[model samples]
Target: MDFFNILILAIVQGAAELLPVSSSAHVIVAEKLMGLDPTSPEMTMLLVMLHTGTMFAVIVYFWQAWRDTYFSSGHAFRSNARLIVVATAATGVVGLLLLKLIKHLVAGNDPGFEIEHLFANAKLMAAALAAAGVLIIASSRLPERANGALNLRTAAWVGAVQGLCLPFRGFSRSGATISTALALGSSRRRAEEFSFALAVVLTPAVIVKEAFRLYQSHALTVAKNGTSLLQLVGPSLVGMLLSFVAGLLALRWLSRWLEQGRWHFFGAYCLVAAVVVLLVG
Candidate 1:
């Protein structure tokens, strides 16, 4: 990718990643428009790097908020930790099961199928976007239950919902989880906190997975560009820093809008976004 291209991707990834919007979908579409292959090793690696940038942005943006809310006392920490575990485990089970089912049902007849093949499917992306949009709108319409925290049952439901997002590219993980939390009666702030916490927990594994994939698929790109993956790391890091800045800004907007009872606006945007992606594709 060129400097300007990386800059655009970085900005888009950073701005949309933390919001209820699906940043992956936006980035892939942008790549398509720019005449780049989303499945290439370089692009995949860049995508994960951008995610890492946004991941740090979440930590930086929410550090104090997390400290006050989640780390106030030992008991609170333990309780929150337990909830996170339950939710994460639920997410894993549901996500893996759905992944398996999709693989078998969608491509069982083809032995050489990779889940990545579904990443750029425009119709699927549109459907996912619409699904996320509806969930967000529905959850936002419900009254917020004030001062709520994640309990076992609620966390499990949230986690299960998160798992469903994993197999589908355009399904917004944050959107779906936060929506599930809200619909389950958690307050907006609490839902946002838990949603981001899950993101932090999940990001490292994603980084590793993308890194491994990049490693496995290195030879083709190496021959084409005469550049090693290691050589690309420097530029990727620059993109990461750019994304981090953009992520911080996006989080500020998301928090403000969410707190001001404007979450449904994001849902509305997602709905429009779904249509746009479908048309553009």
Candidate 2:
């Protein structure tokens, strides 16, 4: 990949990743437009690195808020920790089951087929984007419950919604999880915080998984091209740095819109984006 393409992808990933919009959808569309293969091992690795950049951005942006809330007291810390664990566990179970089911249905006896093979399907991506948009809009309209608090039930719900996002490229994980939290009666602030907290946990695992996949799939490519693993991933490192900066700006924008009761605007944008993707793709 060239520097210009990497830069463009970094910006797109950074911006959309933090917002309710599906970053994967935008990045994949951008890749297709640029004549890049979204399902390629190298591209998938770069995508994961781009996510790593935004994950750091989330940590930097939310550090103080997390400190004041999750770490406020010993009891608070423990309680929040348990909630995170439960949510993560739920996500793992549901995501794995969905992956298994998908592989069985789609690949059958093809042991070599991986989920990434479906990443470039435009129709699937568009439909998932539209679905996520509708969910976000509907959840935003739900009446807020007084004394809405983050509980085990709410966390599990959010996690399950997140799991639904795993197999579908255009189903925004943050959007689905945050909307689920809101619909379950949690405050916007709490939903935002918890959604990102789950992201921070989820991102590293994804990075590791993609890294392994890249190595497994691209070993022959690397040998043929006389490139080391470091050489292959070096460009992604630069893209990650650029994405980190963009992600910070995006996080601020998302926070402002979410706090100002304009959360549904993102959903509206997703709906429009879905149409555009279907046309262009």
Candidate 3:
């Protein structure tokens, strides 16, 4: 990929990552349109860097709020810690089990078959996108409640839904978790805060996973292209910087729309995006 392609992909990754939309889905489509292979070493490395950039964005944007909410006092910190543990455990269980099942069933006897192989399936992406859109719309229409506390049951429910998003390319993690929390009667503001907190908590594992994939690809590409693994660093860093800027802006937009009671509009956009992906694919 050239500078221009990486820039476009980085912007898409940054914004979509925070906007209650699946950056993976959007980025994959963008890659296809740009004639870049998503599975290639350079592309995957750039993606890893993009995610790292966005992860930092999440931290920077939420630091003050998190301090006020999750770290205000000992009791508050303990309570939030319990909720995070429960939710993350639930997500881990669900995501791992589903991922294993998909690998076993979809791969059959093909040892080399991987979940990344499914990322480019437009039909699957469309279906998953539609599912996420429906969930977002339906949950937004539920009776609004004023509950501000995050309980164990609520965390479990949100985490379970998030697990479902793991293997599905177009299913948005933030969308599903935040919608599930809202549908469970959590306040919209609290839901948004907690959903992103979960994201911050879980991002490291995802980065490590992606890094491993990038490393494997690098080993192969280095032999063929006669370039050192370090050679990939410059482009990735540039992409990360671009994505970081875009991510900060996207977070602001998401927070504003969600607070203004316009969260469902993203669902509508997802519906249209689904159709577009289907048509183009």
Candidate 4:
């Protein structure tokens, strides 16, 4: 990819990754619009790098909350830790099972479990985007409950929603999980906090999974004229840094807006975005 393309992907990945939008969907659309091949191994590596950039942002923004809740020692800490573990386990189980079902149902009939083949089917992504948009709007409409810490029921519900988001690229993971938390009676602050915390745990797994896939296939190889991994280092690092800054800014703004139950605006934006993606993509 060129420096301009790398920069574009980096900004898109940084902003959308933290916002209630689906970063994967946006990046895929951007790649398509740029006449870039999404199935390319080098493209895959670049995408993973973009995610890593935003992941750092997530960690930096949530470091305080994590340290206080998960790292501190107290009865409250123990309780929260147990709940987090339970919720994370439930998310993994549900996510894995759903992936299995999708493989058996969608890919079993085909020899390749290639997700890129499904990319041409924009209708599916459109529907998932619509669903995610609706859920976010609904969550925003709900009145914010009084401040309280995480609960087992709320955690489990959020985790399940996250699990559902795992395979569906257009379904915004943060949007779905946060909305589910709200709909299930979690306070906005608590929900957002838990949502981010879960992301911290889950993102590493995704990064590793994609990294292993890239390594196994020697997917980062570039053509003579194509951008090589070494060539990408400077731009990639620049992109990662930019993404980190953008992510921190986005997290701060979103958290403040969420406190006032203004999240429906994102839903409205997504509704419009869906239309644009359908028409242009």
In TM-score terms, which candidate is top? Answer: 3
Q: What tens-digit string does per-residue lDDT give for candidate 2 at 52-144? A: 999999999999999999999999999999999999999999999999899999999488888878877889999999999999999888887
lDDT of each: 0.89, 0.89, 0.90, 0.80
lDDT of 1 by residue, 1-281 (tens): 88999999999999988988998889888888999987777787887799899999999999998999789999989999999999999999998888888889999847788788898788899899999999999988998889766789999999999899987878999999999999988989999989999999998888899888888778777877777878768778888999999999999999899889999998888889899889988
Q: Estimate each model's TM-score.
A: 0.96, 0.95, 0.97, 0.91
Clashing pairs in model 3? none
The better candidate by lDDT, 1 or 3, is 3
By the TM-score metric, which is better: model 1 or model 3? 3
Error of 4 at 276 (Å): 1.7
Best of the two (1, 4) by lDDT: 1
Higher lDDT: candidate 3 or 4? 3
Residue 35 Cα positional deviation in candidate 4, in Å, after optimal superposition: 1.1
Model 4, 38-147: lDDT tens digits are: 76666767766777888899888888877876778787678877777888988998988887788788878566685556666667777778889999998888777787
RMSD of 1: 1.4
User: Each candidate's root-mean-square deviation in Å?
Assistant: 1.4, 1.5, 1.1, 2.3
Between candidates 2 and 4, the lDDT winner: 2
Which wins on TM-score, candidate 1 or candidate 4? 1
